[model samples]
Every structure is written in C-alpha cells, then in structure tokens.
Target: MLKPYNKKPLSYAKQVHHLQSKGLSIHNVAWAEGILAKYGYYRLSAYWYPYRIRSGNNVLDRFKPGTSFEKIVQLYEFDTELRLQIFGAIEIIETFYERN
Candidate 1:
C-alpha cells in the first residue's frame, strides 16, 4: 500500500534552517547547504536519526544536546567507506570460492 507524502519540499537553505530548528548544531552553513544539495535531506537523514532525542519507545524529531551536523556527515562517510571495504573483502572471498 502506498501513502501520500504531504510534506512540502524545501530548498537547501531551508533544509539547513530546519535542521537548526531541530537543534542540530551547524557551524558551516555553506558547507551544510552544499551537502544537502548534493546528498539530499532524505539520504543524510539516516545519519542524524541516531542523534534525535528519544523518549522511552518514541523518538522525537529534535536532536540531543550538542548534536552537530559535522558529526552526522562524518558518520555517513565512515559508514560508506566501511561498506566499500566490506564489499571488497566479500568479493575476494567469493573469488576464492569460485577458484576452488
């Protein structure tokens, strides 16, 4: 089943503003806007999900204290690089099995 996306689209600047409103500490506005433009809000959102404030079983939209946008970007980069390294190892293992 499909549901409607009722939220309106925001510009890169608005996206950064939204993050700030939600308690995300962003020192580099230009870089943050550029990242939003490049990777987009949805793609980068996963990285920030963990920084959101939690209340029991429910997760709040706002971030925890001192949650920085730089940390989110760093996490995203680390995860991406880690996945690439894992895949490279997996490919080697697959090749080894194929050669046997």
Candidate 2:
C-alpha cells in the first residue's frame, strides 16, 4: 500500500493539469494506466464534467419523475464517503495531486 501524506488545497483546474502532466510523463502501459487511474482525486472533475455539461441528463434522466441537483450532490457526497470508508482518506489520495 502507498504511504499517506498531508494534502494541500488546490483549485480544480490545477489538480487536473497536474494529473494530465503526470499521466503523460509515465510509460504508456496498462500497469501505469491502472496505477494512475486508481487515484480518485484525479477523476473527480471527470465525474462532475457530465453534470456541468449536461445538467438535464443527470440521474433524473433515468426516471420519469426527475431528481434535483441537490439530490445529485447528496449522491456524490455519499459515494465519496463510501469510497473513503472502503479505501483510506480522500486527503491522503489528494495529496498526490499537490506533489506533481
């Protein structure tokens, strides 16, 4: 397992740019991709992008009686909490973004 570290706060754009740079720096192999993809912090913006680009097609689209943005936010919050419970701290994973 990877050792944990203190996380520094960063804006969304900064984090994404850092990850893109890190991804490009490594060898283009499945192991590398797997290792990189395992960091959930790097995927946060990608997860939120769909909602940003198409707010109308969120989970609401699946149901005839639609849902609200607040519910989507709650779902994301719950998902993050669950992932943290299953893995370790989100801050621990987020720390890597600052390193790059």
Candidate 3:
C-alpha cells in the first residue's frame, strides 16, 4: 500500500528560515520569500542542489559554506533565459523552413 501524503505547508518565513538553517545565506529575506512564493521551494531546490554538500547517505540536506540565495537565483534566471533563447531560435528556424 502507498503511504499517505502528510507534508505540511510552510509559510514564506518558515521556508526562508529552513534554507538559512541549512547554511544558505540570504541577502534579502523579503526578496527571497518573493522568489520562493513565485517559483516554489521544490522548484528552486534543483537550482540550489549544485551548491549543496553531499552527506554520507547521499542526501543533500546542507549547503556548502558561503552559498548565497542570490547565487541560486542567478542560476535559475540563467536557465530561464537560456530556455527562452532556445525557443526563439527554434521558432525562427521553423518559420524559415515553412517559408521555403
């Protein structure tokens, strides 16, 4: 049988607190909360995963010392920009192909 979903929702402050407790430095709490509210903690987790330190059990519960929330945001922004550029390029190529 599958286990029941028992995860509780966290407030923006709690989310920021959790990330801080995990060694992530936030330059601006409000800004970080806005980002978290917009993209969500789980989605942002992937961006921050690279800065995390691997534990003995292979779990990434802690971040490397000096890892900043801004850095993770930068990575997320870069990914978003790259995706937009790729899509634009594909659209151009498709339009050109259709014209020929």
lDDT tens string, model 3, 1-100? 9999999999999999999999999999999999999999999998888888987759678999999999999899899999999999999999999999
Best by TM-score: 3
TM-scores of the candidates are 0.90, 0.27, 0.92
Count steric clashes of candidate 1: 0
The whole-model C-alpha lDDT of candidate 3 against the native structure comes to 0.94
Winner on lDDT (2 vs 3): 3
Query: What is the Å distance of residue 33 in model 1 from its true position?
Result: 0.8
lDDT by residue (5-100, candidate 2, tens digit) is: 878865544543453443322233343344334544444434434443234545421212232323434456688789878676667678878898
- Each candidate's lDDT (Cα)? 0.94, 0.45, 0.94
Weakest lDDT window of 10 consecutive positions for candidate 2:
60-69
Query: What are the per-residue Cα lDDT tens digits for candidate 1 across 1-100?
Result: 8899898899899999999999999999999999888888899998899899999999999999999999999999899999999999999999999999
Candidate 1 TM-score over all chains jointly: 0.90
- Shift in Å, residue 99, candidate 2: 28
RMSD of 1: 1.6
In terms of lDDT, model 2 sits at 0.45
Give the higher-TM-score candidate: 1 or 2.
Answer: 1
Candidate 1 deviant stretches above 4 angstroms = 1-6
